[model samples]
Target: MTQLTLDTRSISRGDGLTDQAYKVIRDAILSRRLAPGTRLSIPELSRQLDISRSPVREAIARIEYEGLAESVSHRGAVVVEIGLDELVAIYDVREVLEGLAARLATRAADDAFIDVLERNWQAHRDAVEADDVEQHMKLDAAFHRHIREGSGNLRLSENLRQLQGQIRVAMTTTVARRGGMPAALAEHRSLIDAIRGGDPATAEQVAREHITRLRESLHDAASAERHHNNERRKP
Candidate 1:
């Protein structure tokens, strides 16, 4: 429910064949163009990208290491499927990681960086006011992205980024995760204030609470959906 990790940069045009293949495929997976459990047929992918099979295979190997794909016995590599259980698991990890990111960013972020957070906050507010769902979502995503990167902890940033990248489907696809945004924006405002105030304790608590709040919303929604489906299926 936090990242979709947004800022998904495409593979730049100029790069080595293997790296290019890897990036292209990685981006596709992150963007959900290649959905969970979809087959990654090397020869098919090679033809689609108009590249050789070797590079495609190499790309599969890299993504598998990143937890985006797994090699099945005969099915070859397939994208990882994200269900509610997986979604909750990811949010569980992310809430803690994001709390640390906010706490660290309070100490490390400069005024200029805080200015960026303020600007992003205003933009997000505008998006909410205008009822522009896409822009609101993008700004919401960028808000956390700035905090994570601004944390000045490279290892923490990279670890969260990777965890998010591999499981981003949970962010985009589930209906249960949909109802948290309006309230989440208010929580974002609190987090921004905490960071700007340079209180790491408040920042971490606010950050963790923000995520925990959304987690409850999504869980209730998912439970409702399952109950509805079960009732409808009853003969």
Candidate 2:
């Protein structure tokens, strides 16, 4: 299976073995190298990473907590599949929380964080221009991370951080069908402007609107997929 094909080089030597194992497995899920329902075998992963099963087990436990994987009855852990309803539900809560984060960040964000946001925006634009989808995905997450951190609410930041695994899974599974990178970038730009202007209401509005549009796009994709499946069944 693709999940078994771990590239050890990707794991940073500076981190602990468990963190290294966690990152490799997590990246595989986010990058779709390990598609939904793939079984994550501890022995197999340990063999590939040339490490003991202890860290690999710990990593899988963490992935489970992050909602990327689940403990099957007898199958141990497997990558999770998010249905359209659940996906929409996640975004529903995210829209409100992210809106609040942006609202709080508007006044709380300092020059350094703003500078980081600006740099991230520029890098994200470059990634899009170059058609580097992987880099763009990373930058997209970074943009949100920076904003949430700037909110100065540790609880909120932790909450969003927990949501990230599912968010990444959703993005990977649906991004191809969504196909509106430029539109997303524009929304990010608007969000940046609102935060920079220190306009709490505008910032919240922009952030909420951004997530709402994403939810809409997912619905559109699901409809199209259903239509295609129905056409196939018509014969």
Candidate 3:
């Protein structure tokens, strides 16, 4: 397991302590810092952050509601481990909805939204250049999020936000696995160019193609893993 510590500086700004704690813990879980199935100790986190247990407790509750943490009997909260079926389900839904977001974002194109995308893309490039996989994954997630929010479709944005939290591990895994980062970045650059050109059709097409490929890959990987598990169990 990687030693994933909370970045208190990022969380400490502006937001309430509980929200800060929640985001910190959530990012750790998403970045595979805290990792799946790791036991969470409220008192421990509180001690580490020099904060109170109440905020940590509240953060855990919010995390639980978002399906990122599970309350184990006598074991406290543990990060949720995503299974094969959930990975497939996540990519399936994400491909369609994210494509829709890209299309809608094209329609919503303006200086402000485009700025957010460029900034995120630049940050991602820096992360990749620095070989900081965790920061790269964080920017990758943010890159998708900007498109969703820029879509001007409130419901669509909200839905993806909920769904992304649930399947964050998959996104992290996809980027962290290596060898695909540059290709993914090129795809995103293409996406940015399409959106900047205000061509909704091209934007949507590129977005769909990117996600569809990922979905298929994840599906195949999951299937293979499940098969291996079954074989092991039989022997």
Candidate 4:
């Protein structure tokens, strides 16, 4: 098992300047620090991050390509808000790609890979038990990343990493509403079991079901948020 360094702060340092800026901004978006629909001003970002506008502009362009941001006609770049429709579309794609990754991982993974997964699963369970939502989310992301890498497909891993940013936002929103960390842990366990069993069909089925449940939960949260905001606005 490789020593997993979970320092998200330094994730940007290893890449090029523009790439590093992109990751930093992307991480903020994923973690909801930037929030959905937030307008990203290049000058503002450059000042905040103590970098030049050129790199920030480059970063925004890359993020736009990833569908995490959009280039407005005159308003500049803005974070892409995940609507119910986008949520369904993204998860549908995730189900297929993640299931394929799991299937490939099962065929290629050795006992060590399984052990690493089990350890990650246990850590996730512990985080849930402790009611540490942040840690739980981080572990959950790591666990999926491990599976993608273990799949031995560079393209699959890259695609999953890109998609992961969007998924994180939805996951964070859902967790904030439902408060069901234990259920999420159980789902992870089920996913691991299906992969370990070497049953591609079962793996795909479970993956889709898990993502579908997540989408439903997020939809419920979004609806509740809308209702709450409406009431607040009334009086």
Best by TM-score: 2
lDDT, candidate 2, 64-101, per-residue tens = 98899998998899999887667877888889989999
For each candidate in turn, the TM-score is 0.83, 0.85, 0.78, 0.79
The CA-based lDDT of model 1 is what? 0.77
The residue-by-residue lDDT of candidate 1 on 98-198, one tens digit each, is 99999999998788998998899888888877878778767877888898999999999987877778557555432225454567678888888888788
Model 4's TM-score against the true structure: 0.79
Weakest 10 consecutive residues of candidate 2 by summed lDDT: 171-180
Q: Is candidate 1 or candidate 2 better by lDDT?
A: 2
In every candidate, how many clashes are there? 0, 0, 0, 0
Highest lDDT model number? 2
Off by over 4 Å in 4: 1-15, 170-172, 176-179, 219-235
TM-score of 3: 0.78
Which residue ranges in model 1 land beyond 4 Å of their true spot? 1-15, 172-179, 225-235
Residue-level lDDT of model 3, residues 1-235, one tens digit each, is: 3344777776563449998898889888876788788888887888877788999999999998878889999988998888867877877888889889999999989988888889889988888888887787678888998899899899999888878887875443665333567767888999999999999989989998888777776777788898999999994
Candidate 3 residue runs with Cα over 4 Å from true position: 1-15, 115-138, 170-172, 175-179
Flag clash pairs in model 3: none
Better of 2 and 3 by TM-score: 2
